[model samples]
Structure formats: structure tokens, C-alpha cells
Target: MKGTASACGSATVINAIATGEGGAFAIDLRVKSTVSLTGDPSEISGKVGNTEEDPELIEICVEKVLERRGVRDQYGAQIETNTELPIAVGLSSSSAAANATVLATYAALGGEIEPRDAIEIGIESAFNAGTTVTGAFDDAAASYLGGGVVTDNESREILKKIDIDPEWRVLIYLPPGRSYTTEVDVERIEFLGDLVEVARESALEGNVFGAQTVNGLIYSSVLGYDSQPALDALSAGAESSGLTGTGPAIVAVSKEKNVEKIINVWNSKEGRVLKTRPSREGARIENG
Candidate 1:
């Protein structure tokens, strides 16, 4: 039997709220999609291609999972992705791709899945696929639910969803280079032990705007990246600004009236700047 499914996974900016014990909140954006498969895997074994963006990790992941499931040589499938989200730029590209591909493939296989359950499955798949650190349950949950979500990455637990004012516009700054999350020294993160508590408290108070800034500052210091641009955005009238994930990408929460101003400042720097809105809906199946 052969089957196909398509899923959309959003990009995450950071863990807004994180406990020293490891709880986190994520801001999600839906701008990328993935397709998955479950028939004649051998047909796509050597047919996969890379286009400057290193999607090889994701492809290899799918192949390995299928092979382990004893169905590697029995499927022929193609995954084509169209995305505005940049990979390896700390925009949750990998997570989005993983969720989309898994959902698509499951659909192709004639399987059924609940929305939240599917995101959980994607988290497990990503860990097994070696494509993520911390399993990123916060990011995964945000990608699945849209808007903002708080979660425990270790336990794959969702703590809460904070409703963001619709008037907010999310703007991103994309540096010319990519930073791999895996390459980040875990020691650096561990070094910021005390700061995690401060950030987590900010998130719990529903002060995500402050939470993102603090989290970004801590990570920027650890990653050896500049935090000036993000801080500059805030100074320039943006509501909130911070680095996303381990980042080369900086994110700003702004009002539409101020989006252009935020974009101008971000573009003034030596990076690509983008403006986007929060996605209200989570993942959806385009076809059965």
C-alpha cells in the first residue's frame, strides 16, 4: 500500500519561558511546508538533491527512519518544499520540514493522527533523526498550535498558550550566514544557568516581549553574535526585539504601523530583513 500526506510546521524564535529544570515557551511562524511519503523508498534513495541549503540532514533522516522500520527499500516518494523561512538561520526550518514530511508520509500511508499528537510524533522522529537538540518540544508545540506556546522540551509537555494581540507584526533579521544549532557548545548554555531563571520568570508573567529580549541577550552572549541590532530595534520604537533560537536571525515584535521602521533598521545592518505576521492556525492537511 502507498500513501501521502502534507503538513505545515511553523518556525520558532526561542524558548520564551524556560525553567532551570527545563520548561520553555516558543513563538511560532507559519511560512514553510513539507511533504512526506511511505512507498518505494528505494526510488528516492539517490534521487534526493540539495540546493545550497543543506536539507541533506532531513532527507537522510527520513531514509534512516524508513530503513529502521523495515520499509526503506519499498517506497518511491518525492518531497518538494516551498518556504520563506531560511534554514539554519535559527528559524525552526528543520522542525518545520520534519513536521511537514512526517505528516505527509503518514497521510500517504493511510494513517490517522490528531493535531497535537502529530506534533509529538514529529518530536520523537526528530530526536531519532538526530536533527534537533532538546527535542525542542516548545518549538514543536508552537509550530503545531501557532501563535505562542510554552512547553517542557525534555518531557514534551505543553504548559500554556498565551494569546498575542493581533496587532503585533513579527519581523525577522536574517544574517548572510547560517549557524548550526548542533555546533553550539552546550557548555555555553549551561554557563547561563542563573539567567535562565530570570528569563523563565519573565515568560510566566506574560511578559513575552521582555522574555524574548532576555533570552536573546543570553544566547547572543553565548553564541558570540551581536545583540546590538535587536536592541536597536527596540530602541527604535519596536515593541520587542531579540535573537531567535541560537540565531543569526533576529526577531522583532512590532505594530504594523512600525513594521517598515523595524525593517529599515534591520536592513540597515548587513543582513536580510523580513516582515511577517503570526499564524493563527496551526498545521492542516491539504489533502487526504
Candidate 2:
């Protein structure tokens, strides 16, 4: 049996460190994973087409879903994933991969699961693979449900979800630095307790731009990122811009008319600029 799933990367508005409240948006870059029965019943082998990423997470994802379903594998598993998003950066590449892997596993097993159950299974895989800190519920949900989502990560509950117009452009400046979720020190981020709380409130109130901007600046300052790229994006007429996760990559929000302005500012920087639109379609099965 074989199954395929397509999921997208997400830019973090909140890191889920200090306050459980967090937000994220689905981007155009997609990660597609296929899971199939393989040669050995007890073995699960996987490959990530992205060279910088480890495929063990994909294996873990399949195992996690199987374990959750209390199923003893009668056949081996093979999983292969291809992604357009940069790996190990602030963008939620891990979450996207996990989401796709989990869904693909379910399909290969001839089973169906609710979207919430699928997300939980994916988060479980993330924990088993050591790829996350807070389980990245916001990121995973945004990738799975598409569009923007505000959530309580600890509770695994979504506080709000909104669809942004596809016409809005998302400009990403990917720098050389790598900020994996596993490397973050939760205590250091928790120090900015009150600021994060205020930011979370802003997100809950539906002020996505303000909330994301505040969260980004706070995280960038604490994580030792330059934060200049984000400021530059704003100077170039971005409606909202800031560090996406912990550091390294900056995500900017702009209308189509202002895309070139944002790209121009990023072009002067050290990293490459990737332009995409926000996605409203969530993760789903792809015909194989």
C-alpha cells in the first residue's frame, strides 16, 4: 500500500515559549511525503530529498503513528520526502515534514484520522524525533489547516484561525544562520514573560501584524540575530515584518504592489530572497 501527502511550511508569529499562546501562517512552499510498504516487515527506512535534513524524523513519524494505533507492522515501511522549504531554519520545515509523514502513514495503513488526531500524532512524532520544543502546535496547525492560526500550544487548542487573501505576498530572507527548535533554551525566552504575554493578547485580539512584530523583535533580540533585515523590510513598505522563529530568517508581509520594494531591501542583505503567497489550503492527500 502507498500514500502521499502534501503540507506546507509555516512562519512563526510566536515561539510558544513564554506564553502558551502562539501564531503562524502557512506559506506556499510545500513538503510532499510518500509512505509505502517495503521489503522488511520490521524495518522503517526513509529518505529526505533535502540534503541538510535528517530522514530519521520521517521514520519516527511512521513509527509514532503505528505505535499510536497499536498496530504491529506486518510489512516494512519506506518513506521519501521532498520539500521546497529551507531545512532547520526558523520556518517550520520539520513540522511540515512531520505533518506529511503522519498523514501518508495513515493512508498507507488504510486508515483515516481526524485532522486534530493527525496533528497530535505528528506532534508526537516530533517529540520522539527530538525536533521540537513546544511541539510546535501553531506551526503544524497552520501547515495543516492553512492560512493563519492562533493557538495555545500547551493545550493543543486553536484560539483562532483566519484566511488571508492569496494576493498578499510573503517575502522570506533566508540568512546563513541556522536556528533549530531543539537548540533553543526555553528559560532564556521565558525571561521576557510579560512582553510575550502582551504579544499573545495581541494575537488573540486578531492583531496579527502587531503580535508577530513584537514577538519577532523580542525573540531576535534574545536569540542574538541582527534584526536589521526585518527592519529593512519594514522600511521598504512591508505591512509587517520580523523574525519568523528564533533567528536567521526574516518573514515579511506585503501586498502584491509592495513585493518588489521588500525584495529590493532583502537583495542588499547577505541571504537569498524567496517570494511566495500565503496559503489557504491545508495539507491533503495527493494522488500517487
Candidate 3:
């Protein structure tokens, strides 16, 4: 059997670590997975095309999905993953990988998975692969569903979905470090629960720009990440700017004519800047 799938990446508007209420928007960055099952069910393997490191997480993802289908002993596969998103940078790379892997594996099994159910399974696979805490339903949902989502992570339910404005350009600033999502200090973030609640309400009220700015500021302060980049983006007239995920990456949105200003400011900061747009498409099977 053979199958393929793809999923997008997202930036944080509100980290779900606080308030259980969080918001995020999908980006054009993506991870793609292809699964080919051979004879030996014990001969499982995986390869990641975008990085130099081992693809252990992809292997674990496939294993977990097979286990979920109660076919752990019935099949073994060679999985290949190609990604444009960076890992361990709070860009939801793991969630995207897991989501794509789950879809590809199930497709290889000739099974149909409901959309949200597939994302939930991907979240479970993340836990099994030791990649996420809090299930990261907010990130997983945005990556799987596309567009923007405001979620109740405690309930694993998306409370609202917003249509993305095509004019909004997404710029991701990649600093020089990596922060693992599962290793974050949740207590430190939760201390700002009351503030996060305010941000959540702001998103609910259609003020995503304000919500993201505040949430990013609060998290950047408590998490020891420099907030200067976001400030610079705002000074350049961005619609919204803030720390995305944990640290080392900042997400800046702009619909104004001053996109060059934002890009120039980031380029001057010594970190890489990736330009992408809002994604309105979610994970789907590419082939079988």
C-alpha cells in the first residue's frame, strides 16, 4: 500500500498554555508524508528530507497510528517526510508532521478518517512521540483545519473559525535558537492566565491583532524571550507582531504597503526571515 498527505504550519495568536483558550492562524509552510508498506510488519522505517537529523518522530508517529488502528502487527512501512517548516522552533513542526503522517498512514490502510478526528489522532501521536504537552489542540487544529481558529484546549474544541484575509502577508522571523514545545514551563505561562483570558476575549471580539500583540508581549516577558522584534515589526506598521510558539521565532502580519519595512527590520536583526501567506487549505491526501 502507498499513500501521501500534507499539512500546514501556524503561528500563535495566543498560546493555549494559559487560559485553555488560544488562537492561531495557518500558514503556507507545510510538511508532506508518503507511506509505502512492504511485507514485513516489523521492518518499519522513516526518513525526513528537510533536515539532517534522524527522523525518530516520524517513525514514532507511524507506529502510533498503526497501533491506533489495531494493526500494529499487521503492517510495516517506509515513510518519507518532506517539510519546509523548521523543527523545535515553536512553529508547530511536530504537530504538522504528526498530522501528515497520520493521514498518509491511514490512507495507506485504505481507511477513511474524519477531518477533526484525524487531527485528534495526530495530537495523540504527538503525545506518544513525546513531542507535545497540553495536546496543543490549538496548533493542531489550525494546521489541520486551515484558516484561523480560537480553541478551548481544555475541551479540545474549536470555539470559532475565521476566514483569512488574503491580503494579509505572513512573515516569520527565525532567531538562532530552538525551544521545544513540550519542555516549556507551563506554570510560568499560567501565571498570566487572567491576561490570556483578556486576549482570548479580544480574539472573540474580532480584535486578533490586539489579542496577538498582548499575548506575545506577556509570553515574551515571562518566558525570557526578547520582545524587541515584535516591537520593531509594529513600528514598521504591521497589523500584528509577537513571539510565536515559545521563542526564537516571531510572527508578523502586514496588509499595509510597508511590508518592506517589516522585512528590512527583521533582516537587520541577524535572523532569517521567511515570507509566506495565510493558508486556507488543510491536510489532505495527495495520492495513494
User: How do the residues 1-288 of candidate 3 rate in per-residue lDDT, one tens digit apiece?
Assistant: 998999998889888887777888899999999988777887789888846756777787778778888988988999998889987787888878888988998899889888888887887777777777778898999898899999998799888897778578998899898898767888877888998899899998889888889999999998998999999999999989999888678999897587899999999977799999899998888953
lDDT of model 1 at residue 89? Answer: 83
Q: Please, what are the lDDT tens digits per residue for candidate 1 over residues 1-288?
A: 333333323334344223323322223444333344545546543222245554554465455446545677776555555555676787776666666655555555566657666676677767765667677776666666666675666666666676676567878888889887667677657767678667766676787777778788877887798999988899878877777877888888887888887777777878787766666555655543
Poorest lDDT segment (10 consecutive residues) of candidate 2: 67-76
Candidate 3 global CA lDDT score: 0.86
In model 2, the clashing pairs are 41-76
Candidate 3 Cα misplacement greater than 4 A, ranges: 50-54
Candidate 3: count of backbone clashes, pairs at least 3 residues apart or interchain: 0
Measured by TM-score, the strongest candidate is: 2
lDDT of 2 by residue, 57-173 (tens): 889888888777777466678899998888877888888998898899888888888889888888988888898888889999999989999899999999898677889889999
Model 1 residue runs over 4 Å out of place are 1-76
Rank the candidate models, highest TM-score first. 2, 3, 1
Off by over 4 Å in 2: 50-52
Per model, state how many residue pairs clash.
14, 1, 0
Against the reference, the lDDT scores of all candidates come to 0.63, 0.86, 0.86
Q: Cα lDDT for residue 229, model 3? A: 94
Model 1, position 155: C-alpha lDDT score: 63
Candidate 3 residue pairs in clash (backbone atoms < 3 Å): none
